[model samples]
Target chain A: MACSCVAAHLFHGGDFGMSVVIQQIVTGLSIGGVYALLAVGYALIYSVFDFSNFAFGCVMMVSAFVAYYSILAGCSVAMGIALAIAVGILFSVFIELIAYRPLRKKNTSRLFLMITGIGIDMAVTNTAVNLLGANYRPFPNVSVTEPIMMGNIAVGKIDIIALIVSLVALGILWVFLEKTKPGLAIRASAYDTSTAGIMGINVNQVSIIVFVISGVVAAIAGIFFGMKYAIYPSMGTVSTKAFIASVIGGLGNLEGAVIGGIILGLLETFVSGYISSTYRDLFSYGLLILVLLFMPGGLLAKSKSDKL
Target chain B: MKRKLLALLLAAAMVLSLAACGSKEGSDLPGITAGKTIKIGFVGFLSGQDAYLGQGAKMALEDYIEELNAKGGILGKKVELIAYDIGMDPNTETANACNRLIQQDKVVAIIGPESTEQAMVAIPIVTEGKVPMVVTTASNPLVTVAEDGTLNKYMYRMCFTDPYQGTALANFAYNDLGLRNTAFLGDVTNIYCEGIQNCYRDEFTKIGGSIATEEGMMASDVDFRAQLTTIAESGADSILLATGSYKVVSFVAKQMRQLGLDLTLLGVDGWYANELLDLAGPELEGSFMTNMVSDDDPIFADYIEKFTAKHPGTTPNVYAYYALDAMMSIEWAINQAGVANSTEIMNKLETMKDVPVFTDKLTIEPDTHNPHNKTVSIIQITDSQFKTYKLYTPEDK
Candidate 1:
């Protein structure tokens, strides 16, 4: 139905017609895949902690820099990815331990936690700026710059790889959450942190686990973003979309995060492709408002009227 | 009674010192005595994200000053630069800097606060303070003229206004390059981009070139694939990139190629950065852009060599050249006026003609307060480097 809606716009006199629509969809899916990785990470933390992690974008930035410098130091792309993941996990865990754990122990309000996240984000961004100057550093050894031509439509190899990897990662996470014992503990903590602790689930360990997962996800997304765009200090600003995606998906629901991300990406591309690129953001934010007003629980969110 | 007397004496001493400190900085107006050093005020971003731009302008101004002093100074008095860092926020810091330059430093003239926002802020202060300021590289039309078309007589700009560059691009694309149909892509959020884009549209349409589509994106956007795809199908042979960031230009160029949109890319001065080459070298191989001055031009050869010698490991960018031009304008005004008085210099600047600067022999139009008859160099990316395509001057309509 969405494809048809886009196709209808093309009949108004585009040369390439349906091919342009196909290309836009491919690009949208790729960006959406990256957004999903970030949204799910945000949702994971929110489910347990009940606060937005504004610093999530900064962690992605750190990972991108790690990956960028690693490549510059003559490491292979695979090696760079591995190093980024390690650094991302370390940085996220450290932020949690230093900034969040103590606050959580004090039983501070969620607003305080959100403020701390903002502070951390600003500090990280400033430090990165001072350390590495604000020049755009393009990712090296991204071998798939060429697009594969399927008939008349062009498909980026990186986009295909990104989409497949994101789906696979999300699938594995789903299996882990549904079938594994530790995953059950995480779910329990998501339901009620104090009750989970009382039931001997070790909520602090779950927090660590959640952050580690977030790190891994951020590392992958950051690398892809760096490849698609260039690595810069403020590349984490793109995480604004992920935050919006999580909101549209229902803040703490992983499945909803995926759906919301894809929806946002597809709608953004459609707006840009058919209508006007300037309206793309306006449309996305408009959809966000409409979703909040009408379906606050989000598209795939479970019935939680009290939570809303 | 003795302690009270001591306190009163201390207060008197502090007031006397304050009065002395005020005198040391001299009068709150731009002027020069026969043997007194001429104070030139400079305000720009010194520390923050835009520090590099400010530093470039500062260094260029300082280098020019050093050269002037070595050559027996302007009007036989040493030219002293009183520079203040505006930091980042133009709204608050620019006013303070302009005020300090006018009231405290008592500079003969002021230069810079390079961005349009800071330049506009300096206008009211400079006018009230009765000081003349030559802003370096604030290209907006409203920098010198208000929205109501009232001129800010005290303010002048070193670079060509935004409309001039846009018209030049449109003329070059239509008459020179023979491009009949084109598409426009610009950052809607940036005034610089929008200004040029609007002018280009107006001129391009007036010249009989058909615009297939016009698109807008945010300055912060890193992705241009969706936009490029739409542009590809727009049936245009070329596209105009009115974005202010080299990063965005490179992204668009690369994505355009990735999607197999093989159209000619035309850009503004924003695409002239070195990093643009690194980001999308092959993609932008045949693309064209408009710039202030061509490096290959003999006019800037001496200035470039001297500037490079003065500042090692760095060649001067457009900001440096614009700063040099601003300094030259000030020197010319002082020579023409036969004094360093602000009102006299401003009067000289208004009717300034045939003043030779590093880029061109400049003539500031009294009405617009922008340099007239300035050449816009057309640059093309050839073999991963900027090559001088042409030195174009848009014919007066």
Candidate 2:
């Protein structure tokens, strides 16, 4: 009878429990979707080039600045978004040709690439600082202020929009990677560049295509992030947190990135609401460490292997 | 081998250039006379996460130095400011920076250590070095005052200490605005917030005002919905925001609007951002804040014109004024001392009274080295600007 009573108490106020659960789920999905986008970029570049690009954060920051400067120059919100994406594409291409291409020819070690990547990151960030004064500036608002009511829970319009757009972009990317001929060539290059080259696949062209897509994903994330939070010259540091999300989700798994991001987001919100907000990040990272201890291959690793 | 030789020559040239700069130092050196070149060092958070404050302080310093140079410098010396970026981790770097300036650079004085945390670390170093240092930011009284209630001889400050500023805000809310019941939202991570909260709490309760809710938030928190909801439901007459610009604006405006709270908002100098007005929109229109100076004051106007004429691009922030006041105060102390020695300047600085500037008519108490009889401005935000409602000098209340 006591056990039954406790269960009843836990499940009491059906509407409240349902709404709270829904709110947590929605918040997790929205933020996780953002993490998924960033992880996809990180994973794609790593898989193809076997290189860690430290300048990824700077790429995002520069894209956000492009959007900021565009809006400040009397452009509409749509124009700002377009400018960010365009700049991201251009920057990615530039970085690939200037920084990565020569190293690729030399078949540089992963460590060497990582060091060069850090140097590039510093150069880019410092250049941005020199050009734009170090101050926080707000992004032009494109989000509708109204919160869409879903039962007892409410979600902002931007949250819903970001989730939808992220899912759509991810879907398009998945199709491009699976259904197209270039997709197979890219995968072939990832597994064995020599094999791909012998099979008449232009590996260099595939690498450029991969970078372009990664840049677009990062730029979209950057634009959406700036819309939510204010932009600063060092705002790239925020991406470092997302990188943590990426690592927790599993380093090379795209789907794991999504799962990890959502789980981390939900963990943060629930902990912040119930426990101390100061310990929210602590809880998330602690959970990540615990999960790694138990599941060394990550939660979504099984799914990726099964599909492969 | 020729390429290697070229690289060697280039490196040697760079070292040679640096050595030339190194030799041309110290005011009393044969080639460097006191009236020919004045060297002052600025140590602040010039790089790292909190670089924004440093940027503002640097802008002000640049403007003030230009103005001084144009006006034939201090006693005909061309004032040259050598700045060092101490970063945010002041405990580790501030002392080293101060030592480098005093021992190696041989600057006549130093102008900053922008944050209170940085100042605390730097004060002891400057005092021990016997070099005069003027802190350009706020720290509590305990920083300068010894346990025996004597001021550190080499330390001085241009900004009002947090206790006075905090109490001034509370006094403004209770007496000037006639709001009695208040709620306090303190940032636990910041010493500034904690100091101000304590002062306001004590002063408000003493003045017959009740604090309905007292809650805390971390400095980095952007959301204050839960706290604001509690404040709104508590039936408080006003809410005291005691955080920096980013969190203060977003949390107050968004949460207040969300909860439909009609309480008057009051803040300290932390709310002095044009972006805050933009972000907060109509929510900040009738808000009151206690500040040290307002941009529209005639004293500030003359300074602004002079600053603008000299430094054409950078807009003068409040920190610039404080930085200017800091350097100028040191120049004045040195002029009064009529000597280059640290002890002579320290002696003159301790007994400084009625030092007039664009910001205030400051008089330093001999015992505390703190500005006595200073003026505080009560500003109201209307149409996204600070309109000075009242200028309360020390004698006023």
Candidate 3:
């Protein structure tokens, strides 16, 4: 049904014919797959902490740089990817310990935690600018750049790689959350941190687990982002889409984040394909407002009227 | 919490004040006590990505000022430079820089605040201060002229506009390279990108060529496969990037090549940087760039030597050359007018033409204030060197 809606909106007046729309949707799904990876990371953090990690994009940036310099240091792309994820997990854990933990210890208001995240984001971004000298650098040639031709439609190698990796990561994440004991602890924390602690669910351990997962996934997202585009200090700014996607899918809901991300990506590509490339953001943001006004809980969010 | 907020605010204020200090290193400025110093204020970006340009500009202006002073100065008064560094794209920083130049420094003329974005912020203050300023190397057309297309009285550009950049690309792609089916990718919110894209498109279509695909990237976008895949299906023979950032363009170019498409990569002035070789690497070897100034000019051989000597190991781009030219151009006007007054200098500049600078013969086109009769050179990266491909004038009057 969503595919049909995309086709209807993507074709500008049945005059251009029934072609090229499938190509746009496939490409969009790939792009959306990367966005979903980043969005789910954001959603996972938000679910447990109940505050946005504005610094989430910066963690991805650190991953990209780690992967970039690792490759330059004679490591293979796959090794760099692994090293980046490992580094991302460590860095995310460190940030949670230093920046977020202090606020939690103080029993601070949500505003202060959000502000601290912004400060962390700014600090990380500035440090990168100072260290990297603000030049955009690309990751070493890694992913297969050639596109696989499937009849009339074409699929890029990087897009396919991104989609497959993101799907696998999300699947693993789903299974972990649903079937594992630690996942149950995380879920308890997500319900209520105070209550979770009272129920002997070590909230601190759960926080570490959440950070590690989010950070590892973001590492993939960042490296893929650098592979797709070039890595620069300001690449974090582009991750604004992930935050928006999370919001669209209903913040704090991992499944909703993936759905929202894919939806946003499809709508963006359709607008660019059909209406005008310039109006793509205008349409996407407009849709975001409509969703917020009409369905505030998001598309697949669980019933939590009090939360809304 | 209140105390913490106060400390943070105080820290921020201290940093800002330090940036605004603009450091009075060279203002020993002969003739200051004699009331005969021709004070000219300058603003160059000493921070951020384009900081190298600022450092070069500052070096060039200081060198030029010393040379003029050694030669008994402009119209017998020693040229004193009051310089400031615009840290980044902070509006408050721009406002403060402009305010310091006009109000605090009391300079007779002003030079710079690079890029059209900062220049735009500096415009109203310079206009209100009635201090004629020569902005360096920013190609956006609206910097010299108003959004309504009327010329601003106080601001002047030291480089060619985007329309000229567009003309160079179209003529080179059509007449020289024989590419008719071209695709364009640009960021919509960027004035420089949008302006050049529109100009290139108009000129390309006007000359019987058709655009294969037009794709837009948001300022924060990193993925171009969606657009690249779409363009591949459209069968564009070449791709022209109107995105202002070299990194963004290089990424797009790399992706285009990697997508198994054999397409010619074309670029605007934004692509001409020393760091481009590293960013784009072999992917951009055969790529062509339309630039305002070609490096092959024999006239600037001496200037180039001096600039490289001053800032050893830094290869100067068109921006550095323009900064050198801007300083010299202002000095020429001061000499021609026989006074350091702003009004007289502006009038002298208005009627001034045929003045040879670092680039070529330059003129402030009667009312538009654009550099007239300037040649836009088409160059390509051959074996990592910017080899000259072709040259054509955007306007000839």
TM-score of each: 0.90, 0.80, 0.85
What is candidate 3's CA lDDT for residue A295? 80
Question: Which stretches of model 3 miss by more than 4 angstroms?
Answer: A1-19, A76-79, A141-144, A303-308, B1-36, B70-72, B90-92, B140-142, B145-151, B181-183, B188-206, B211-215, B228-240, B258-261, B296-306, B394-397
Pairwise TM-score winner, candidates 2 and 3: 3
Query: What do the candidate models score in CA lDDT, each in turn?
Result: 0.82, 0.71, 0.77
* Colliding residue pairs in candidate 1: none
Model 3 CA lDDT for position B267: 88
Best candidate per TM-score, number? 1
Q: Which numbered prediction scores highest in DockQ against the true structure?
A: 1
In order of lDDT, best first, we have 1, 3, 2
For residues A1-308, write the lDDT of model 1, one tens digit per residue: 23322332442344666666777888888778888889998888988889988899999999999998999899999999999999999999999999999999999999999999999998999889878877787888775556666655667777888888888988888888778988888888888888889999999999998899888888889988888788988888888899899889989889889888988888988888788887888899999999999997776667532221
TM-score of 3: 0.85
The sequence of per-residue lDDT tens digits that candidate 2 reaches over residues B316-351 is 767777887786677777688665445566677777
Q: Docking category for candidate 3? A: incorrect
DockQ, per-model, please?
Answer: 0.35, 0.08, 0.21
Q: lDDT per residue, candidate 2, A1-308, as tens digits?
A: 23322322322324444545565566556556666778777767766676656778788888999998889889998998999999998898888888888887898777887788778878888777666755566676553334455444446566678888888988888898889998887777777677779989998899889889878987998887676555666666655556666667666566777777777766765665445566767887787787689876566555332221
Error of 1 at A140 (Å): 2.1
Give one digit per residue, the lDDT tens place, for model 3 in B129-221.
778888887778899899898888888888888887887788779988899989887787778887888888899889988899888776555
Per-candidate iRMS values, in order, are: 6.9, 11.1, 8.4
Task: Compose the digit string of candidate 3's lDDT tens values, residues A238-275.
Answer: 56888888889998888888999999898887777666
